[model samples]
Target chain A: MPSHDRRLIGAALVLLCGVAAADTVYVTLEKDDAIAVIDGATGIRTRTARIGKRPRGIALAKDGKNLYVAASDSDAIQVIDAGTLNVTGTLPAGKDPETFAMDPDDRFLYVSNEDDGRVTVIDIAARKAVKEIPVGIEPEGIAVSPDGRWVVSTSETTNMAHWIDRAKLEVVDNTLVDPRPRAATFTADSRQLWVSSEIAGTVTVIDTETRQPLKTISFKIAGVTPEKVQPVGIRIDPARRYAYVALGPANRVAVVDAQKLEVKDYLLVGQRVWNLEFSPDFGRLYTTNGLSNDVSIIDLASHKVTKSVAVGSHPWGVAVRP
Target chain B: MTPALALKLLIRFNRLSACAGRILLSSGIVALALFQAAALGGPAPVRRQTPAPVAAPQAVERLTLAYLGQLAEAAAVRPYFEPVVADRGVQGARLGLVDDNTTGRFTRQEFALAETRLAPGDDAEAAFKRLVADGRRFILVDLKPEVLRRLAALPQAHDVLLLDVSSRDDALRGGDCASNVLHLLPSRAMRADALSQYLAKKKWTRWFLAVGPAPEDRLFADALKRSAKRFGMKIVAEKTWTHSFDDRKTPESEVPVFTQGSDYDLVLVADEAGSFGDILSYRTWLPRPVAGTQGLVPSAWHHTLEAWGAIQLQNRFRQQAGRWMTEADYGAWLAVRAIGEAATRTRSLEFEAIRSYLLSDGFALAGFKGVPLSFRRWDGQLRQPVLLVQERSLVAVAPVEGFAHPKNELDSLGYDEPETSCRAKP
Candidate 1:
């Protein structure tokens, strides 16, 4: 009640806030049912939290105050306080929320629920799943257009990608291709979308406006089976001139010419290179090699694997600090 | 010639000319025969009638080699399959892996849909069946166990010989074992036995414990314990870490501390969760080294596994994937290799034919597992020497100095048939 007491209470609150901020770290989704919070700078995993069955698909809110993780086994998205790494809330999205994309403004989030054959849209501020848009079978990758006008999801089973207008919450077009279209990344200027066909062992380039596959670039590596050169995750540099793809069984990343849609070269990485993350500045690309249980660091400037950091077993998902 | 004389003379002349001509012709014929004989030197030189082009030796056709796994996209198995495919006279080969979301983990959707959606329902089994039903005989599968099982059970695939190349789970080998599943990856028990025998040989008997929740992890732990017991080792301390919980302090502290000092010579943490096991190393209070899931780990393949004739395999895999070898990549590679070996040796892909050949005494597969690999008659698990590796390098192999089995060396490592809890037969 006294002024001095109020000051003491305020100081304690500030200290408590500082402690929470210090302890809060990046959350890493594990292959099984666990999420590990690793110090962003130290790289030491501070604590591991068990969430839904087979926890994966992690995304931080724009303000960095909250984190949403797909507890795949439980079929729900668990929201945690970014500062404390504690579950603050949860929302049921769809059958399996494997990967998702957030809008530029961070107001809307789109998720590719692989099992349900649908994309769930969530209102970030409302903390709720707003809509579920049906897609082709085995929808895996989801990406928002640079203008935030449309969302795109790739269906593995259908070997196609569906372009949806966020306002309409409807599938406007489908870009058909070979089997197992896993990942999709938009060019920097938003003129084209690059899709990786896992089963066909090729990368399909599509016109963003027409939503039609225009060019398909295929590479045949000797000794590598056509069945195993599955292309999974994909990303384009900010300049939009170069595209990098994670080749699954191939154990390499295919660098493509953005304009020509031709494969430039394959950069080698760890065994079973799965998901990947590029530094915000696009200087370093980090890839998770599931079977090897390691993270490969690729220096983009050199376009080669610079380091392989041993991480948890079955390193699944990866995220980097801005 | 006149009358008789002229006729005689003419006849003589004609006869002489005819005789001379006959002699010349005979000489020419003789010379030709001698040259021909010389040309056809040794045997009877039997010339059989030529057959049509269809009957000529068939040229090997290029194949599309498919690989299926959770992380099929990133594994280095391409190297192993690539060289084999090239050397085997395959005209061309294309490899395809299953697709996943950005994270390497397979969602329920990806796993389920992958079964039917990967190719058409006309996958290898269907294609093999259609080909077999139409009279084609051979088939090779480096597919997962469930897929292999499903395909083998199909009536269409019955006549089409199939080779099992993946899925290392021992149950698939011993009990639930498919008559057709020819595994490329050594069973978990084989690896456990490898480590167990090594520990026994080193006289490291006492073991501390940290077990995770998965049934597979427990099985591995049980195998380790079985090997320890067979080698006269003891499990002194045991602790369980339930998933989905967290503490600010280190979870490694859950292991009880004894004032009298630790009882075990090594701490074996069977944490397959992948998140916590690496931290268990060097964190244990014990003065000795750790084993099992972390510390000194036992695996079928490692990228740094260069010794014991594994350099070639390592080189091939690195060249293909541009990365070191992972256990799964090796497993997949072995599966494909097993099929190739069976296909080439037996010259048939008939399921029964390949199975019989693979089970025969002559079938030995050279995986990158440091030794010749084969299946046990009793359990059907691949008999292998497990590599005990530390810091990415192989430290030792199993069937340690003193641990001995009457029949096979791999038997020295895991639960013997006599002590077996797995009651299934091969």
Candidate 2:
């Protein structure tokens, strides 16, 4: 049989297995003002949807209908219809919105306005900002707790992770971490919160119950200097067994045991990896490589990079929809 | 309402506790309520329905820093270059104040810079006295070694912390180290060591040393010799350039003959004033590369540096100073930023608290050099990655790959803690 027919048969087999292979991975190209959509099964870029200028920190609606992208330069979040792959509306965000976290209930979005040093809380239903909670300087990373009771904003310059009370809409506590904190993620159990410090090259795990740091996991790779191992974006596996941290400029992702709070292995990926997302079924992981302008597909079962799909210029944020 | 009444009200409110009183006073809401009540002439009812005590107000702390330097009588110029007239060091301090205030606005801290530039023949002691009398406790010094030594020896110097941003003489960090002085600029030995590491990494071990006539040039050449010895490199040939030539009138006939005796991999120029080194790169007898003070110069900061978010700093400096940031500017900026970082981290403006925080393990500052910079305890020298840059581009950053240290890799490019002679501590 010819190679083309063999590939066709392989595709038919995958589809006939009842595997939901129509999932789409959306990657925000920061410099190109667009989002590249990639087919999850084929690992091929499907289309590019034009977004607001300098769009970063993408989040899909819980129902998988609308996609929200933080347009850093435009100071707004561009809402796109996931089915149509077209922008639906623009929601006001604070100045220089670099990252955001949508609440579990999908009623509110917490956007980290880096330059403004505040987190703008927006009502998803109203599509407008409702409150601005002051945080430490240069707030970048934002994560809402799994139970939707707390929101954490990591300030890069202040080196503090602010825990904001969802009910009070005020910063209740500030926990100092390593230098240049960039990303935050909560475990599936909602008991541990992991924050990545890009410059200090460490991931600080904070206990949600006590509001104290439980451990600081440091990364050291062979042949790579400590200064170059900058941990930026973090994503916890759906089963809460492993945590993947994107070590910027190290061109690798650190697989950390979520419960043990230790780095298990450093999986080599692409250059300057920034953000990551997992497939709906947790069978694969997608990472946006900023410098290499591509996305690495990691097969969760094998814990290795299976394929790399070229994306757009300086791809930064990623979102996956089933 | 009379000012006395307001003072009386505040004193009565202070009975709650100093911290609570401060919170109420700084909140601006209490004052607004008081004004409204006073306008309505009904203070009793308003006092009964006081709003619940909210979070503490953001209190602003003010810190004042001083810049002390001397204006040279004559601006130094290269053979045919423009005279350098601008006070680059002071400009950096000013930019530092701007940067600190920017972060300050959000952190409830205000920073102010007091600049004092002495004219020629001005008594340095008198200027120090005036600054001390003005209650300036932090000083950023951009002066020669002689002047710096004189200022450090003054009676009031003990009360002030001096950040040396200009001088690179090794003796200041070694034998003549002052208890009150912290060196921000990399010493000549550090620069030479950085270059030697790069040279060793490139396998260019043999070098021809060319020393200039000035005393500073001799010191730099001595540093180069020490670096070559430390890094296990060989100095193939050495010469002192004592002759001067007018670029327009001199012929190229003697250039090749003057450099012909050397059979080395690179020519190390020690001209600190840019007098003769600019003419040595392409004019060398051997087809070797030129480095040291001119060619592949090792500096604390360079215009071509764009890594570790340095481009943001460069853009900010250019926007404020209307020019590119120079090495001296970076040194001064680092000094002021060190103070800012300490103040922000410690949340105290006390000199001792800030000083201790700066020397402690908690004082890692992001200097846009790809690493968090800190100070060496043995000597008050800022440990940073030195950039080896050409005129137009960054060639490499020092403490090259594979060079390992038992402790910090940055120690590979400078005097490590074990070898330092200075014993100053906070």
Candidate 3:
């Protein structure tokens, strides 16, 4: 081998070692039909691994070794080995698992089957579906509370978010909102939940304890059509001072003042900005611009798009590892 | 009298008084107004419905779309080649027509002539702008990239979607893209990718490339390289061929210069400028087939592409243009379809509403690519299945055979979402 080739191999090996030690977040871009494993500290996609058909929602196991991806079209949950970056197993899931939630212990997964109007609870150990909890039509945006006490699922067609008690697997309360309630995120304290409405172009703040909508923040960009700007995903910053909402079709992400319920700024990313993730250190934010076929990286402190990295086509749903 | 009974009596008396005489009509109107004032339902004022204004069909009547200069002015109206043309026959509607003389260079003398024939006086750009501003949105053009780029950059075109059926450049699909422009041509990259995919499937992994001596020829070469890298194909050898080979006495010498006896699975030619790709095909001594810009090629609209409801489209084009529609013609047709479909769905020509309907999930378009094509949010490039064609027949399509995105099945063929470099609000 030439001396330069030897040097190149040595450098690659060192870089590989560095990657192995660094925290990694594996995100399944369901629409892109691939999983982008991002380096959490770097905010860059380290590698991309292919999975089952129409993969949508993704959940990290408690151990953070296995990533579960719900392939809606294939009607299965693909289990990806984080270390090997390979699809290890496939478990039968409900129809159109567009969104999913993971239990605290990671022993069970709650998958929102959008087409079938139900949530399937899968036993992680056995790799089989254990139970099905019926929900409203086109169920999306499934999120479990940090305490593992409640599971919330949004039904787009019905425009409501159902809060289910994890233990009982029964609906404790239902909060109604404007049309096309797509996604929701809970505060660290679990006292409040923020839900984004895809159709009405608004976000509703709900008190988890009261199970009622507290406030609604409606937003619009000048020169942009009000109807086309459908909000889809929500992610709270690590400091919990602000929230980022992905405005679909408008190609922007709205930064919200968490307490005031006001849009602080609209960060222009690319066409059809749908899902987002924060870097492990909380210094950077990465978003999947579905139409642009790229990921936009935002510097958290600067609140500006620092870089745009090219990725696969129709990138949807992003995750960052800590 | 009780208030309710008094009001009812007053209303009835007003109706009776109106019929009595003109003098009674004034008294009846006054009494009815008084009754209405007492019967006010709520704090909000009653709103009167205003009739919707009817949209007037445009004057300057038919917007004339000109094709690339390669087509003869009268050729667009000929029926012998109608079935292959995409936009020729739209209900036999007679519209103003223009001709674009397609030259390999950027000189706009002929374009100037076409504009003159359109009767563009002083300030032609202003005239074009005024026409578009007045809701005459239909415009067919076959100008080069720079010309189209300039036209799209005009403030007037912000509301007008410029359909590019002429240039097949891929850069316009993403980073270099303009917001108001919609590309009709399946990019050279897309076509090359489709061809490379077919070769990869056939296990023709190694290739000998012959580049033509032209600037655009390099684009084809670049596209092939990208496809080769993407599909795990390798470039084993390469050579350049001139348009004329008068000095070369033997074909063996030319083949040896390209291959040098190195084993390659295929010979990929890049001669879009039409140098020597046609002659190089099937002339390789290695017995392997030739593909790329010539030989077994990938194209958008082929005469033999009768599958996937293409026959209907072909028939329509034949009826309109009176000839066969080429790939570029199909691109223009698809662009029109996009606007038409969006406008029909929204029931308005308002830019915002139409743009919204186009961006929505349900806005799917069938464009003879076997499946519906949609815009990628990442780069706004329309993701349509590419047809790997040869001699007016399809060999395969990329997301060919086994390519599938775990979510988007069509994503398997070309660049998927994860591979994109676009970011907005991170």
List lDDT for all candidates, in order.
0.58, 0.80, 0.62
True contacts preserved, each candidate?
0.00, 0.10, 0.00
* Total clashes in model 2, counting residue pairs 3 or more apart in sequence or in different chains: 0
Candidate 2 lDDT over A1-322, as tens digits, reads 9866865665576457655456899999999999999999889999997889999889999989999998988888989999887888988887768789999899999998765567999998998899998776568899988877678998776678887767666665567787778899988767778999887789999887666789999998987867678899888976778999999888999999987888899999999988989888777889999899999998766676989999989998999999
The superposed Cα distance between candidate 3 and the true structure at residue B299, in angstroms, equals 29
TM-score of B chain for each model? 0.64, 0.85, 0.68
Which ranges of candidate 3 are over 4 A from the true structure?
A1-25, A29-32, A40-44, B1-426
Quote the TM-score that chain A achieves in each candidate.
0.84, 0.93, 0.89
On the 0 to 100 scale, the lDDT of residue A87 in model 1 is 83
Return the TM-score for candidate 1, rounded to 2 decimals: 0.42
Tens-digit per-residue lDDT, A1-322, candidate 1: 9866865665576456542132223435466466655543234566666666666677777777778777766777878776676788877677657788888798877888765567999887797888987675467888887866568898754456776756566664555665556778787666778887665567888877555678888877655644347787888887777888888757888888877777888888888777777765565677777777666777665576767766565666765545
Cα lDDT for residue A212, model 2? 74
Q: Measured against the native two-chain assembly using Cα atoms, what DockQ does each of the candidate structures obtain, in the order listed?
A: 0.01, 0.19, 0.02
Question: Which pairs of residues collide in model 2?
Answer: none
Q: Model 1: runs farther than 4 Å from truth? A: A1-27, A37-49, B1-426
TM-score for predicted model 3 compared with the true structure: 0.43
lDDT of 3 by residue, B1-426 (tens): 333343233221101111112332343234333323332321231232111111221221112232221121221122333233222322111111111111100011111111211211123355456557556454444445655667767887766655565567766554466767666556777777778767767888999888878767787788788878888899998777664646854565675456556888888888775445655655577677888877887776776676433654565456546676666666655655555445444545455776667667766554655455666655555666676667756677665655435555555544456765433200
Top candidate (DockQ) = 2
